[model samples]
Target chain A: MEVVDEGSDGRVARVSLLRTPLFEAHRAAGARLVEFAGWEMPVQYEGIMAEHAMVRERAGLFDVSHMGQVEVRGPRALERLQWVTANDVSLLADGRAQYSLLLAPDGGIVDDIIIYRQQADRFLVCVNASNREADVAHMREHCAGADLVDRSDEFALLALQGPRATEVLGELTDTELSEVSSFAFVDATVAGVSCLAARTGYTGEDGWELYCSAASGPALWAAILDAGRDQGVGPAGLGARDTLRLEAALPLYGHELSLEVQPFEARLGWVVKLDKGDSIASAALRQARERGPERKLVGIEVPKGGIARQDHALLDGDRRIGTVTSGTRSPSLGKAIGLGYVEPQLSRVGSEIAVEIRGRKVPARVVALPFYRRPD
Target chain B: MEFPDDLKYSKEHEWVLVEENVATIGISAFAEHQLGDVVFVELPATGDEVAKDEAMGVVESVKAVSDVYSPVSGEVVEVNDDLPENTELVNDDPYGDGWMVKIEMTDPTDLDDLMDCEEYQKFCAETSG
Candidate 1:
């Protein structure tokens, strides 16, 4: 990244904004671009609400190339993965993906990652854009002897999510996407581009995440849209992506899972396997679980207006109880929904609280995880 | 993005319409488009005194929160009562039904301080570039 001088229009240039391979496609589709992490990405194209509904009803495509991918291979790859991650890696067979976390030594979360078991001796991990460099560093430090390589630039990831995901992608690929069960992946050719199509997504919809070469990203994106045009496939952006994920109650790295927050406190204790033989924070996690977590993650809903943003103090009357991590007006639920940390006693559903929004206390209540769920 | 010639524009992207001593204020279409979807709006109440070039209200879009700076100093005579629940009007018709406030001016010459459509258009191009 480099700092550039001001433009001729007297405007400061965002010179460091990294453009993904699908940047031209997004611009051609009339996207509203914004800086995310270091990438200049689309926040919306048609509208967040419409795109949100489209994903829930029909299908939506997302360019997630900003998310970094790491390749781990060698004879000791499995042994190394089981030691660095918080999940039971041995249980994850080939072609399967598991949601796991890279835990810091202090029992804090470094990043929530997805490990795709490519083979007996190889794996691929997807990490957050903001934490990509840090996550790679963490893995390299702990994952000695195994061939760990930063393969981020080698792949462009696209997420086609919704009930019609299989159908839309089915039209473009010969993989028979319906055969790719949840969390399973297969090497396939899509629109003449080689891809690894996996039945995994953040939107909590029936969908596939396609990993293709960076050079074929723009072509694959255009081909998917062109193939799924009649299926009402809209190219969704980060705006709809945030709203959709919020509705699903998925923890974003910086928001819910951070260096300061532990897995137990983030309500992601299920991913932690203390018996998995001394992973990064296994001992600390055991100690943490023994002495109950100080605070727990709870869903907060503002039935009234005024969206509660991150760092908005959660209150039990005048006393500050916790803080909101992520908040948005959920397009699917038609209510302002958010995730926050609160004392364990007040973490139960139906417990009442208030969110301080712009100096005003907006009435809110503790709710269950996931403000919305797709039709079965 | 077209800024109507009849409406005076503020550098902060608020549009103003003057009739008699009172001026109706709203964010320009350019501002609304820049702000994706307005999820919430907070307006000054009637009888509240607003100063020129000062923040009088707030407009929260999906991605960002921005202060709605008042272009003229005046007594707040009217506020859009329907705007709290119907914030989409700010995006739907920013020039007409989306008018946020009506300020009875203490200084009628405040209009001279703001730019016309052409000047504001150039300002938008320069800033956006």
Candidate 2:
């Protein structure tokens, strides 16, 4: 880790960033490193477009070690989780995962998370890197009787995703990965390393997210790459990750889910169980459901010449509509795609809208999300 | 990495080739390398008037969009018609076919603020380090 100091004026400040266990491996592979969530992580290994295409066509490996993991276990773990989470945690059977959110008192999202049920009294919670500490503190404040342990640093997570991911991962493991249904995981061994392999991914592709010891990250990464060498498996970075997830219409913590934005407006109302009795923020959320959301999150498609970057305003012929949350040139679609909030009436599938891109009002339209769904 | 001795460079990494009063403009090799995989390019119109140190056009990659700044104030005479469709020219041949626009200079004295090849190379080094 490098601690760089900035003294542009008289005052001095020190900035030190943490690194994943595969930091040296990424450096040796000639990746462009960037600061993400106080961690030094790779933004790109090859070009973003090429890597994006690779993940869609073949398999790609991702080092998602920056994501935090917490083990919550006790006699009251299930009851405690149901109290803090927006989703009904009681519905998940053992080895099943549910996408849920931690909400503030005002029904604003604290962090979107994945709760993996390991047993009746135990669960593993996966959280975004930036919100890990805050989420832990929030959980502790609410669930004092439950045992909460931060295990983010103790494990490294690797996501292998694509159309060919099953075939590639099959070569190294004896388990029948095809039988493991979506959002379910099993304790398995891959490439001679023990891992909890889950059939879940952010890329909206058929894949497995392997959670193993931090010390085994480098070897596991190399072995998977080597095992899939003939299938053109490559290491993907944050740049490709963002584009892939956006095409899937998955909400990021800062961009789509935030402390200011409530769940219903972000198209996350399905995850909020207002009828689930006595949960945090459920009262405020029930009132919000009674009074429908003013703005709804929709997909935006721009024409030629302009790329709709974040914070660009959405307009309906000079009428202030909403603001863009995240935007990028879709490598798979070969067109401009973005996510933004707009008035509910304007959120229809083919409503015509325009986005302000660099002082010009480019022609845009509200479109359906999950812009690039994989072939069935 | 290749900065032609006959050309002048700006801190924004644009290169200018002054042929008499008209200055031809393009991004340098370093800029193209830093912005990998050029996906779109928007050049100024042929008759548009451009001001020095101001945005003249736009270049977009997969992740970001960057504005191309003019090094000399001028009236655009010729624009790159091939670049909008063949954006890879900016990354492949940044000095030749990748040339963005040719402008008839309004103030030729703006060339005094430009850096030569050696100076531009040193500037890139210091900024990168």
Candidate 3:
């Protein structure tokens, strides 16, 4: 497999882009296709704002089949996973999922992953699209003596996310989705296709992600869209997906998690189980825990006006402090918000700062993460 | 896609409405359509002087930023103050409510070089292809 490098700046190389199974569906829906993580994916269908609003108010369907999946099965699967990944795999109960990370030997992040414990000795690891090849190589090197299979090409993934996601999905599947709590999974049939239904999503909304055979993708997609036609279910692309995740403060791979960034620095320290017996980068993470991270990631807002974008320099009275990692004009809040890393001391909430945009300083303030949250 | 017959257009996709010495300017519908969705706009002050074919303002969409060039040289007499908060006007009604600026023309002869609606419609088709 050819491994393409998508730089930290988010620029794509003009190579032959791969297509998902639902590429024709996106084109039929009038989606604007853009190359993302080496795949020709839909960036937007109707518009970013309208699709984002639809997902928040009703339901949205996303074709995330480009993401890579790995299966580890054997009597020693748990031991091998515990040795390679940062989190304690033993804590993951059967039919439950966990958000964890694959770490380098020096505590740098390889990729942020979600592990589904399908059985006592079976696991399904979902990895980022851009890091699929590298993650497989890394896993094979460390996770020896176990049957590790790269099942990325065999499965198609769809994320149905929003307030009415369950209601819409419930109509098509007899999985009793409501009983599958957050971060849980069920192996059942959806739309007459056998699949794994997981109640998890990156949009910070209550939703379920379905994984089915590649040949079953188009059929299931059509059925869900038909079932969700009345619930305001719209075909959403990556553009709305990005803005929604940004509002939720969920980090993307290249933007928030990178080889040079540690979990603590990215405000993802919860996934790093230092006490979880000898795993990859445990020693380095222990030392970093002792010394404390010098820099910290923070959520920032330009309450007055102006949108800050990636690579925009942040300033403290002309002294350069950090660079914005992710930013967008929030469709939900009707304000500009972003995420960046800066000196730990400067990351305090209410601390005033400035973002330099096109040689002009835009006043900003540090705010708490997750710029948007679903009200109970 | 929309070239208003009442306005003259620049090659850079800006539309100009010349009435006496005052020239009202905004982007063409083709420009707005190519720009997806407008989320923010940055404009110059009312008194700022601007030269024709130069960058006078910026229109930012959800994905990218584009410069709005001046169609004719002039001193800025007025700017659309509501554009900062409601940038969608550029996408909704580019010819009317979305006018970016009104200029006190420094050279009315500059209007002679601009394309009329018929010529601009052909130009848009050729350029887009």
Model 2 Cα displacement at B113 (Å)? 2.4
All candidates: interface RMSD: 1.3, 1.0, 1.0
- What CAPRI-style quality would you assign to candidate 3? medium
Model 2 Cα lDDT, one tens digit per residue, A194-302: 9999999998788989999999989999999999889998999998999999999999989987988889999998999876798879888988998999899999999
Best by lDDT: 2
Worst 10 residues of 1 chain A by lDDT: A1-10
B26-120 per-residue lDDT for model 3 (tens digits): 99999998787899999989899999899999888877788999989989999999998889999999998999999999899999989999999
TM-score of 1: 0.96
Off by over 4 Å in 3: A1-14, B107-129
What range of 10 consecutive residues in model 2 chain A has the weakest lDDT sum? A1-10
- Tens-digit lDDT track of model 1 for A171-270: 8776777777899999999999999899999997999999999999989998999988998897999999998998999999889988899999998989
Considering the two chains of model 2, state its CAPRI-style docking category.
Answer: medium
lDDT tens readout by residue for model 1, B1-129 = 678999999999999999999999999988998987887889999999999999999997776788999999999999999898888999999998889999999998989989998999999999778
User: Higher-lDDT candidate among 1 and 2?
Assistant: 2
Model 3 C-alpha lDDT per residue in residues A1-376, reported as the tens digit of each score: 1235577899765457888888889889888888798899998999888989989999899999999999999999999999888888899899999999999999999999999999999999999999999999999998998889999999989999999999988887777888999999999788898889999998878998899999999999999999999878978989999999999999999998899999999999998887878887999999998899988899999876578889999889898889899988899998889999888889999999999988989999999888999878
